[model samples]
Every structure is written in structure tokens, then in C-alpha cells.
Target: MKAAVVQEDKTVKVAEKAVPKLQPNEILLKTVSVGLNPTDWKHVKNFSRPGDIVGCDFVGKVVEIGSEVPVGEIKEGEVRWGFTRGGVDGERGGFAEYVAVDWDLSSVVPSNVTPQEASSIPIPFLTSVQALYIHLGVPEPPEKVSGEPWILIWSGFTAVGRYAIQLAKLSGFKVATTASEKNWAKLKEYGADVVFDYKDPDVVKKLKEATGDKIEYGFDCISEKGSVQLSQQAFRPEGGRLILLLPTPSESELPRPDVKTSTTLAYMMLGTPIQWGKITLPAQPEDRACFVRWTKITTELFAKGAIKPLDVHVVGDLDKIQEALDMLQSGKHSTKLVLNVS
Candidate 1:
């Protein structure tokens, strides 16, 4: 098997390695397409294990399933895509010809979603769901939303932000969002009722005014400087909850006191809390349960066209993984980037 591994000095090189051995409930996947996220580059920069595989989020064909797999739900040669972390320490990721993941973590890709498109679904989409339903306590998604409970997703054009907007809408909240000028209509098409330009100086005020400051939920997909600060202000004066993809920045960039805040780190999906900086957080019992519920719901949504994948820009084969990561790191591609792992 061939996989991309981080070298001692933190560079990725395609290297030959043996295929992973599967456990009783694990499925062996032959990689088809792997998605790139900003975290991929971050892991590369903080290379820990010299030769560990270096990617996450993939769509692949099942070469084999463990004996314990549910009888009719999945089978050999089936195509699947789901959430699993890769490319750090000794944990194998999806950047290789073959990888193994527990069966509970994946679902068969529906016909409507190509391997490439499905590849981009896991991390960002799951991140949004975790941020909303788990971190922020938004209700479960209903088939038909009755009321116009509004929530604001700052940076809504982002991969995670788009998912947040759609999920918020499905979960029965009226959605408002801020994005660059070019992404307004795109966000609207995804169910954002109102879209504001985040680049505008008065954006927070404008968004609050548009929603009557009743917006109580926010997801900061782009946690750059000033993003959380601006997003927290859009909530009503009574106070609301905000979710950050990363830690809230320094005291200088802190959001207002009225906004209760939390973070949704997707890695918590691994069933263990991460040792981030000096913080030793406890594991989240909700993440795995949420992933199970969400995988069932979102896969059905994908099959029925209730939700859709972002446009995927396929960047060729396994050897081009580095190029794909570079594109994401440079912040050049507007759509999701997928690498065909032939």
C-alpha cells in the first residue's frame, strides 16, 4: 500500500506501507476520494509521528467488512464515506490506498452523492452539527420547521458555515448569515433568510438590526481575528450562545459578556477529549451518540435531496494530496477540495 506520511521535518511524502489490519467491527476501505481541510495543514506543521498517515475525511469502496458488521446495512465492495481523523501521531488517516475505520463511523454513500462530493461531507458538516446540537443545544432537525426562530452563522459561505446554515434551517431556526460580498446569494440558496457582508464595518449592527437582535445562536466557522467579537454582538441583548471552531482569542479579542460561549472541536468525535495547550478537557459522551444519530439522518437527507453537498473541485490523484493541502492553506479555493486517491 502507498500512503502519504509526515517526515521528520514536517513535510508530506508518499511512502510505501502495509495495509491496516481490521478489528472485528472495522471496515477496510480502498480509498477513492479524500477531502482536504485547513486542519490537514495544521497537523502537517505540528508533525508528531514521523511516518503516520496524514489526512482525514474520505469516500471509499469497502474492500471487506468485519464479521461483526450489521448484516444488511453494509457489505463488501460498497461505497462509504464518513468521519474519521487521520495524519497525526500513529493514527492512520484516509490519505492512503487503504485505511480501516470502525463500521459505526461510516455510512454507504448514496447514489446522488459522488465519491468526490461525499468525501467533503464528513468533517465540516459534522462540525456544524456538533456545534449546533451538541455544543449549543439546538433542537434536532425536523422535517418541517414551524416557526421562524432565527440564528446567525458568521462566515456562512465557508464549508462549515454553509453546513451550519443548512442544518440550522432544517433544525427549525430561521437562518441569517454574514459572508463576503460574492457569497451572499449562495448562502441564501442554502436557506439563509438574510445575508450580510462580513467585510462591512457595520456588519454586526446591520445583522442585529435585520434580525431585531433576537438571534440567539451563532457559529463562527472562520475564527479569525474579530470574527467571534463581531458575531457575538449580533445576538440579542438578553444573551445568546456562540460556538467557536477554535478557542476564543486573547482577552483583547474577546466577545461581549452577554454572549455565552463554547467551542466545538470536531476531534472530540474520537470519544476522548483532546489535550489542547494547557487544557485537559474531559471526553464528550454526546459526540459518538450524536454522530450515530446524525449519520443516519444526514445520509437519509442526502438520499432524499433535503440537503446537498458543496461543489467539489477534484485535484487529481494521490500524489497531488500536497497540492490540494497547499490550495486550502493558501485560502484560494472557494469550493471544497477533493483528491481522487487512485
Candidate 2:
């Protein structure tokens, strides 16, 4: 298989590598599409090393399942979408033509969604799902808005932020969001009742004006610039909950407030308690169960078209992986970038 290896910082090379085999609880998948994320290049450049093949979000057909796998419920030929941990096992990752998927992290891709679309969902959707529905006690996806809470997603144009908006809408939140100017209208279509431009000098004022100063729930999709700071302001004293997709501050970075804050390592959160327990710090059963229920809910929303995948910037071929990465880093791509691996 021809895979892109990060030979060093800002350097990548297409090289042939042996295909990976599945472990007892894993599934072997022939990659059809790979979603490029901000982290892919960040890790590659930061490490300045050759080892990590860091692409995560993926969608493909399961070619083989382990003997211990109970895939009969999912079926062998089903299309699926999911996140993979960085550096799966000992090898690099989904940048290649194949990946050994841990069964627990995988989910069936709706037949109606293309591989490119499916690939875009796993990481971003799971990020929003884990953060809002599980961690913050937001309602489950694909459910009617029966008593749903209000949520303010701080970056509605981001892939994760886009998913957060759609999920909140589908699960029954009166959603509000902040985005770049051009995306404000699109965010409205995605179900944000109010959309504010983060670039506006009065962005925080606009948010407060829209919510009437009773801010309670927030999802901070951008870690830097004005987004994080404004989010802190929007959070209500003790009722506030903020979930960050980026690295959250230690006690030092946290504001002295009664608000609750959490960060998610989304792929790892899909595990069963046993799987999580193996890592030494397991998810509480309650947390694990909420994730499971939300997973099913999000999957159903995708299947029913209640929550749509973000419009993707489809980079034409695997050979253009570098260009795609460059585009993402340059902040030129407005939507998720999907590599046509097939």
C-alpha cells in the first residue's frame, strides 16, 4: 500500500508499506475516504519526527472482522464511520489504504451517506456528542425538542462546531452560535436560532443581547482568539458547562468561577467500561452509558437526515494530501476536507 509517512516536520513522503492485520477485537477495513483535521498537521509539525501517521476520521467497508467480534449485528459489508486513536497499535494510520479498526470505536455508516460524508462525521460528531450530550447533559440526538435546553456553540463554522449546531437542533435545543461572517446564514439553516459574527467588535454583546444575559450552556469550538474568552463571559455562574475540543487549561488556566469545564479525547470515549478500565482511568458507568445512548442517537440522526454532515472540501486524491493539509492550516477551507482515498 502507498502511504504518506511524516518523514519530518513539514515533510511527508509516499511510501509502500505492509498492510496491517486485525487483532482479536478489531476489524480490518479498506479505506475509502479519510477526513483531514487541524490536528493532523499540528502533530506532524510539532513532533518534527517520522513516526505518527495521524489522520483519524474515516469511513469504509469492513473487509474482515476478528473471530471474537460480534459483527453479525452490523453485517460484514456495511459501510461505517468512526474515529481511530492516533498511531493505532504500532503503525501509522488511515492515511494508508487499510486500517485495523478497534470494533468498539466503529459505527455503521448510513447507506445514504457517501464514504467522504461518513468520514467527516466520526471525529466532529463524536466530539460534539461526547461534549454536549454526555458531558454536559444535553439531550440526545435525533430526538424531538421536548424540553431541550438552550446551547450556545461558539464556532458554528468549524466541522465540530457545525456538528454541534446540527446535533443540538436535532436533539431539541434552541441553538445559538458564533461564526465568521459568511457562515452566519448557513448556521441559521443548521438550526442556530441566533448567529453572531465572532469578528464583530460587539460579538459578546450580541450574544448576551440574543440570550438575554442568562447564558448557561456553551461549547467552545475554538481554543484561542476571542472565542474562548467570550465563552467564559457567556457562561452562567454555577449552571455553566463548557466543553473544549482543544486542550483545556490546568487549574492555572481555569477561571475562578463556579462553572464546570471538561475536555474530550473523543475516540477513547467510545469504549465500553471494560475497554476504558483497561486504560487504568475508566469512564464512570454513567458516563459510559450516556455516550452509548448518544452514539445511537447521533447515528439515527444521520440516518434520518435530521442532522446533516458539514459540506466537505473534497481534496481530489490521496496524492494531494499535502495540499489539503496546507489548506486546512492556512484556514482557507471553510468546511471539512475529505481526501478521496479510493
Candidate 3:
């Protein structure tokens, strides 16, 4: 097998390697499309992490299954997609031609979508779904809009932010978002009731001013200066919830002291009954499975056309993985970038 290996000098290259051997509950996937994300480049820059394979979102056909996996998990061949653990030091990711993930980490690809489209949905969509519906304790009551509940999604054009807008709309919240002027129209098309340019000097104030300061839920997809600052302003006075995709550093000073804040790094735990305060750090695999189930449900919603994958920039094949990463790193690609892994 040929894999994209992150070498000791912190560079990526194609190299020959043996395919991964699966464990009892693991299934082998023949990669068809792999999605590139920020973490793919972040990992390579932060560490001279050798032999690392870094692509998480994958759409692939099942080629092999471990003997111990349930009969339901395997088919002679089944198209499936999901995110593998792409933590800097975690398991080999889905970048190469094959990936072996626990059955819980994989879901059958939605039949109505093409592999490239399906590949763009899982990682960011799952993360957004987990962040909003789970970590923030938003009511999951069937969509009943008593009036628009002002919910702000900072950076609403990124993959996660795009899904955040759609999911909130599906759940009956009126969405307000911050994005570049170029993406504001697209954000409105995704059901954002109001959109603000992040570049505006008073972007956060503009968002609050437009919504009459009634924002109750905030999902910060961007963890940098813009998102953090804007979300702090957008959250309501009391009972307001803020969820950050990046873990809040222990030493970090929070701008909003009145609002309850939690980080969503343990993405799988979102939207479950488990309280955020009770969760143990360095999550167990079973704990992670909660997120897996969350993703499956979201994928089903997407297939039924309840939620949708946002604009996908398909940049050809696995050989172009580095190019995809460079696009994301350069902050040039507005929509999700998917690579057909043929």
C-alpha cells in the first residue's frame, strides 16, 4: 500500500507501507475520498511526528472486517464515511489508500450523496452538531419555533460553521453569523437570519445590535481572536452557553464572566444526557462512541435532506492532499475541501 507519511523532518511524502491490521471490532476501509482539515497541517507543523498519516474524514468501501465484528457491520462491500481519531499522536489517520476504524467510528455513507459530497460532511458537521446540540445543553425538542431564538455562530462559512447554521435552523433557531463579506450571502442562503462581516471593526456589536441583544446560544467555530471576541459579545446575560471547538487553555482569561462556558474538544460527548461537569478527561473509547452515534444521526438527517453539506471544493485525488492542506492553511478555501482518494 502507498501512504502519505509525515516524516521526521516535518514534511509529507508518499511511501510504500503495509496496510493496517484490524482488531476484533475494526473494519478495513478502501479509501475513496479523504477530507483535509486544519488539524492535518497543524499536526505536521507542531511536531516532527514521524510516520504519521493525517486525514480524518473519509468515504470508503469496506474491503475487510475483523472476525469479531458483528455481522451487521460488514458487507461484501459497503460505502461508508466517518472521522477517524486525528489527534496529533493518535492512530494513523485516513490519508492514505486504506483506514481501519472501530465499527463505532464508521457509518454507512448516505446513498443520496456522492463520495466527494459525503466526505465533506462528517468531521465538521459532526463537530458542529456535537458542539451546539450537546455541549451547550440546547433543547432538542422537535422544531417548534415560538419566534426566532437568536443563536450566533461565529465564523459561519467554514465547514463546521456552515453545518452549525443549518443545524440550528433545523432545530428552529434563528441564526446570526459572522463571516467575510464574500461568504455573507452564502451564509444567508444556509438560513442565517442575519450575517455580519467578521472584518467589520464593530462586528460583534453589529451582530448584537441587529439581533437586539437577545442572543442565547453561541458556537465559536473559529478559536482565534475574531471568534473568541465575537462570541463573548454575542452570548446572552444569564443561562447563555458558549462552546469552543478548541479547548480553553487553563491559563486563558475568559472575556465573559457571567456566561457559562465549556470547551467542545471532547466532541463526541455533545448532545447526550451526560453533564459536561461530570465528564472525565482523556475520554475512554466508550465515551467517544457517544459522538459516533451523534454523527450517524446527523448523517441520516443529511441524507433525508434535513441538513446539507455546504459548498465542497473537490481538489482531485490523494496525491493532491498536500495542496488541499495548503489551501486550508492559507485560509483561501471558503468551503470544505474534499479529495477523491482513488
The digit string of per-residue lDDT tens for model 2 on 112-226 reads 7778888788778778877876777754533454655568898888888888887787667788788777887888888889988888888778877787765678899887764
TM-score of each: 0.95, 0.88, 0.89
Judged by lDDT against the true structure, how good is candidate 1?
A: 0.83
Predicted structure 1: clash tally:
3
In candidate 1, what are the lDDT values of residues 149-233, reduced to their tens digit?
7788988988999888888888888888888878888888999999988888989889888888788878889887788888888
What TM-score does model 3 achieve against the real structure?
Answer: 0.89
lDDT of 2: 0.73
Model with the higher TM-score, candidate 1 or 2:
1
Model 3 ranges with Cα > 4 A deviation: 87-91, 140-147, 249-252, 266-280, 284-289
Clashing pairs in 2: none
What is the per-residue lDDT of model 3 for residues 199-262, given as tens digits with 9 covering 90 to 100? 8888877877888888888888888765675687676666487788886634256667665666
Check candidate 3 and list the clashing pairs.
134-270, 134-271, 268-291
Give the residue spans of candidate 2 off by over 4 A: 87-90, 141-148, 237-239, 250-256, 270-295
Q: Model 1 segments beyond 4 Å from truth? A: 143-146, 250-255, 277-280
- Model 2 Cα displacement at 239 (Å)? 4.9
